[model samples]
Target chain A: MIEVSGLTKRYGPATAVDDLSFQVRPGLVTGFLGPNGAGKTTTLRLILGLEPPSAGRALVHGRPYPELRDPLLRVGALLDAGAVQGDRSARDHLRWLAASNGIGPRRVAEVLELSGLTGVARRRVGRFSLGMRQRLGIAAALLGDPEVLVFDEPVNGLDPEGVRWIRDLLRARATEGRTVLVSSHLISEMALTADHLIVVARGRLLADTPLAGLTARFPTLEDAYLSLTSGHVDYRGVA
Target chain B: MRRALAAEWIKLRSVRSTYWTLAGVPAAVVIAALLALHASSLYDGASAEAKANAVVSPLETVAAMIAQLCLAVLGVRSITAEHATGMLRTTFTAMPRRGAVLAAKAVLIGATGLVAGLATLFPAYFLSRWIAGDRPLVFNESTLSQDLPSLLAGASLVALFALVGLGLGAVLRNAATALGAIFALWYVLPMIALNLPAPWGPRLGAVMLANLAFQLSGDPPYPGALMLSPWIAAAAMFLYGAAALTAAALALTRRAP
Candidate 1:
């Protein structure tokens, strides 16, 4: 389980995440919803201890992420697919990460097969297309088979088939009693995949409710989200 | 920490650059040693002073100087390449203890540098000795003993330069910029030190890496050169490497990903 309480992050005079509080329960796909610059990524970074929170705290399994004995076994995350050495083959890239967590080569091969990357596992990441890179990232996130998984924009560059594959994967992961938190701008995709929603705008929590409850007040989840975040968007284009 | 070390080792060896750099060290050493040996042979008809200068010193010194630059680039690339490719995020994410990660990188790279240094320096020394056969320099028990320390010093110098590169790479976080900084410090600054007036010129040259390596290896200091004793020079080079790594660790820990 993931618990975030009164979490806040401020950069100079700009507040990125303000008094954010939420709980992500196991066996559910929790959608972290926010408009552009709405602090979703910042909140994820804070949870992972990539950056210290200005106030409050984020805990994974009731302790800070950095305090975990074996962090990879508890929480697996893919914040950026491009955050890998391009010259390393997919197999080598995963091998090193696995080594760090004391994970063996068997699981490395298993994940490659599971992600449908076995064919290209030996190819350099520099030569991979964006879709192939996403699969590699997903393969890495599954390297340890943690109880909790976090992915930011996992389906951004995937083809239609790949998109469907991830949607099924997320649902299957949640069914197996894992806590999955996915952040995305695809409201339609989230509606189909997420069970719970945590919406934010301008770094403030606007709504935290079940998907059904959030969609009950409007015709669709997007309609309700637009209504709640209409005035909170950080940028406005010229009329 | 063991796991972190293992992971770092894999990361170090998995890249093509690592192989290129490791291979380049011996290639550079062999080529430089051959050239230096050729140059030494041409001193057959020179003055007694010139022959003395050529016979007493091993060609490994010149080869080591060239090899040190390659090892330094290897060291710098080890860390800077990670930063360049954003692999640092994945690395730090897996092992959140920032200092431990940096330490693992230092240990792995330093060890590789040491091994490469020894592998290249020994052969170069023996080859140079063979090439200088029949020269007035006698290979007595005392001279062989002296040669051993010099060989060790040359190897240690390679490792030290690698550590320096690692530290600078971590602090700078960019391959090109870090390489430039290291080049300036290793080559340019020493050149500038040569032209400076007294006391200061020797003082600066004394601490410069190349000069320190020379002194540590028991080579006669250049004219007007001021350098510490062998042990002190080794210690000083170690200190510089330590200082660079410490600064790198601080920068990594204090900065957000």
Candidate 2:
């Protein structure tokens, strides 16, 4: 399970994630819902120990992520679909990351097949389309087969088929008693895939409850999200 | 540490540029050695003192300079490629201890630099012996044996340049800027150092990592108290490497993806 308490991240005077606290339990998909700049990405970065939190803590399996002896074996994360070297072939990219965790080449091939990227495994990531890159990112994330998985905007550039593939993959992983925390702006997809919702806005926790409970309380999850983030949206001005 | 080293090795090998840059080191060394030998032959009629001090020294210095650029390019390419392609984040995620990762990268680059340097050294020696003209260009044990320190120093400079490049990339996190900064430090800094006043100028010259490295290798026996001991030079090179690595680790860990 993933536990975050009073997690806060700030950029100078601008707060990206503020006093956010939520718990993601095992055996279900926990959807992290927030509008644009709702601190969704910042929260994930904190959880993975990619960025230090200004306050409180984010724990994976009862310990801070950096403190874990074998982080890849315990938690797999895909913060962005394009966080990979473009010049390297998909196979080699996964191969290196796998080697970093003491994982073998077989695991790399396993994830390629699992993410449906086996056919293009030899191609450099630069040649990949957005959808293909997303698949490769997913392949990298699953290389360790960890008990907890964190994905930010997993379905951002996917086709219908690709989207369905991931939805099924996530559900299957969660069904196997693993904790899955996914952040996205798409409410309808979350409604279809997530069992629980942890909503935040302007870096602050707005609600954390069952998906059904959130939908029942606010009419639609979209409405709930808007109510939380509507005020703090950074409006880009026109000349 | 072992796992991180293995991973960095794989990362370096998987990319075409890494191998290409590594290949360039020996290529530069051999080509420069050949050209230096050819040029040295033109000065054959000169006096012994003139040949040793003026002719061979300058030629060897040129060879060292050329080889150093190749090493610097390799070093900059190693880390800047990650930043350019956004692979650093993935790397950090896999191995969160920032210092360990940087150290592993330095170790891998250093080993690769040493091997490349050693490879170049033997080939250059043979090529120089073949093309360097008569006047009894000694291929004997004594003459060839004396050159080992220079070869070793060349290798150390390559690794040091690589570390310096890694540090520059870490600071700038841009390939173009890092390469430019490295060029400025390697090629441009010495010229500027020459224009400065008295003791300050030579002292500034001493700070030129590659120049000091070249001097460190030349004629192991010391004639004057002004010369720095080889151990002291090696320690200073290591100190610079450590400083660069510390900066890289801090920049890498503290910065956002």
* Candidate that scores best on DockQ: 1
Model 2, native contacts kept: 0.81
Candidate 2 residues lying further than 4 Å off, grouped into runs, are A217-220, A227-239, B33-37, B40-54, B58-61, B136-142, B195-197, B218-226
Tell me the whole-model lDDT of each prediction, alpha carbons only.
0.87, 0.80
Q: In model 2, what are the clashing residue pairs, if there are any?
A: A18-A203
- Docking outcome class, model 1: high
Candidate 1, residue A182: Cα displacement in angstroms equals 0.3
Scored against the native two-chain complex, candidate 2 gets a DockQ of 0.74
lDDT by residue (B101-169, candidate 2, tens digit) is 888888888777767666666566656655665544333224656777777787777778888888888
Q: Report how closely model 1 matches the true complex, as a DockQ value.
A: 0.82
Best by lDDT: 1
Q: Ten consecutive residues with minimal summed lDDT in candidate 2 chain A?
A: A228-237
lDDT of 1 by residue, B72-135 (tens): 9999998888788777878888998989999998998889889888877887777766666667
